[model samples]
Target: MRFSASEGLRTMLTAALVVLLLRWGPQQLVELSRVWGEWSAPQQATAVTYVLVVYVLLRSGRGVQRRVSWHLSAPSATALRAGSALASAAMPSAGGSLSLERRARHEAAHVVGFLASGVVVEEVDVRVRPDGSEGRVVAVDNKGLAPVEQAWGYLVGAVAGNVQDLRDGVHDGGSAVDMNTAQSQVWRVISCGVRPAGYDGPLTADALFEGARARAGEVLEQHRSAHEAVAARLVEYAESDSRVPLSGKDFDDLGVGRVPADV
Candidate 1:
C-alpha cells in the first residue's frame, strides 16, 4: 500500500498544480475586471495547494490498489510471478551473455532499419589533432545523428557492449565505463540530436533504460511468446561466445568489416 518515492512526489506535485489553477482562476477573473494583469501571491499559493491535495489522493489510491493486487496474486501464483520478477530485476546484471546477445540483435535492427530508412544506430571514426596535447584518438561518432527509433537500438548496443567489456575484463584505456554510463551517454546524445517526434526535454540515461524496461515488461505481460523469443536468442548468442566479451575486434573476427562505408 506504500507509494514509491517517485510516485509520491508526482502525486504531491499534481495536487499542487491543481490548487494553483483553482486559486488562480478567481483571482485572474478579478484582475480582468480591475484591469490588472497579475495574480496575488496568496491566490497562487492556495491554488497550488488545492491541486497538490487532489493529486495525492488520486495517485495514492492507485498505488494502494496495485499493492493489493500484487499481494493477492502472490499467493496464488508465487513461483511464476517471482521468477519473472527476478529475471526483470536482474536484467541490469545479465553479464556478457545477455549483453552480447542484446548487442547483436540491436545491431541487426540498426543495420536493417538504416538500410530501409537511412537512419543509423552507430557511428565510428578516428580523430587526430596533431598540434594538440593529446595524440590521435579513436572515437565512436554519434554526432549529427537525429534521435529516432534507430537510436534506441544504438543505445542498447552501446550499453551491452560496455557491459560485456566489463564482465570479460576488457579495458577502455582510461576509466572503465559501466552500463549506466553507456545508457546515459547514448541517450543524452540522442535526446539532443534525434528529437523523436513527440518527446521533448533534456534526456538522461535513466530514461533510456526505463524505456527498454517498459518494453520488456510489455513483452512479458502482453506477448509471452515474443519475450521467450528474445530471451532464448540472447541466451544462445551469449553461449555461442563461450562467455567471452564481444567487441569492435569481435566484429572483425566475424568478418564484419570496419564501420560501414557511409558511416
Candidate 2:
C-alpha cells in the first residue's frame, strides 16, 4: 500500500532510532547530550529542526495507523444484520418440534419487521428437515435506521413466533440468537450515542433488549395485517418448493408497507 510522505519519513526515522538504540544502548543518549552542548549555534538549530520534524511525522503516523486499524476491525451494520440472519437460520428448532408452517411465519414476521423498519429485504426462505425446520430472511442497508428500529427488526421474529405459539396453545421456544443479536444492535446504537426511550438506567444488554422487545411488539401489532399476508403467502409458496425464497417484489405485491410515522 502507498503511504504518505510523512509516513515514509516516520518509518525511516523509527528504523534508524531502533538501530541506534539497539547498537549503542542508553549511553547513546548521554553521548548525544554531550555533543549537543559542544555544537555551534547553526548546528544546534539544524538538530532541533530535525527532531521536531521527526516528532511530528511519527505522531501523525500513529494517528493514521489507528484509523486504518479501526476501519479494518469495525463491523458494518449490513454485515451485522446479515450475520444475525445466518445465526437465526442455523439455530436448531427448539425440542426439534417446530413445524414448517411455524418456520415460515417466523421468517415472514422478520420480513415485515425489516420492511417496517426501513431495512431492505432481499429475500426470505424456509427449509424443512426431518430433525426440524429453519427459516431466514435476507435483509440489508440498515445504515441509516435508528438502533431501536434495527433492534426491533431483529426481535420481531421471536416475538411474533411466540405470539403465534400462544395462540396455538403451544409452548414458546424463542431463538436465543435472535435475542442476542437484538441486544447487540441495541448496544451498538447506545455506543454510537443513540439512547432508546424509557431507558434511564445504566446501559446493559438485558435493559436494551427489553426496551427493544416492547417496541417490537408495538410495531408488530401495528403491522399485523402485513405480517399475516406475508406469512400466508410463505405457507402457499411452501406447497410447491419449501426452499424457494420469496423476493421483495413478492412482498410488495402482497401490499407490505412502511411503519407508521408515529411509530
Using TM-score, give the best candidate's number: 2
Over 66-183, each residue of candidate 1 has an lDDT whose tens digit, in order, gives: 9997754432110100011111223233332223344333323222222222232232211112221110101233435444533443443333323323334544321123244335
Worst window of 10 by summed lDDT in candidate 1: 77-86
Residue 248 CA displacement from its true place in model 2, Å? 2.8
TM-score for each model: 0.25, 0.58
lDDT against the true structure, per candidate, is 0.36, 0.59
Clashes of each: 13, 0
- Which 10-residue span in candidate 2 carries the lowest summed lDDT? 79-88
**What local lDDT does model 2 show for residue 137?**
68
Candidate 2 deviant stretches above 4 angstroms? 1-75, 80-96, 142-174, 196-204, 242-244
- For candidate 1, give the lDDT of residue 38: 38
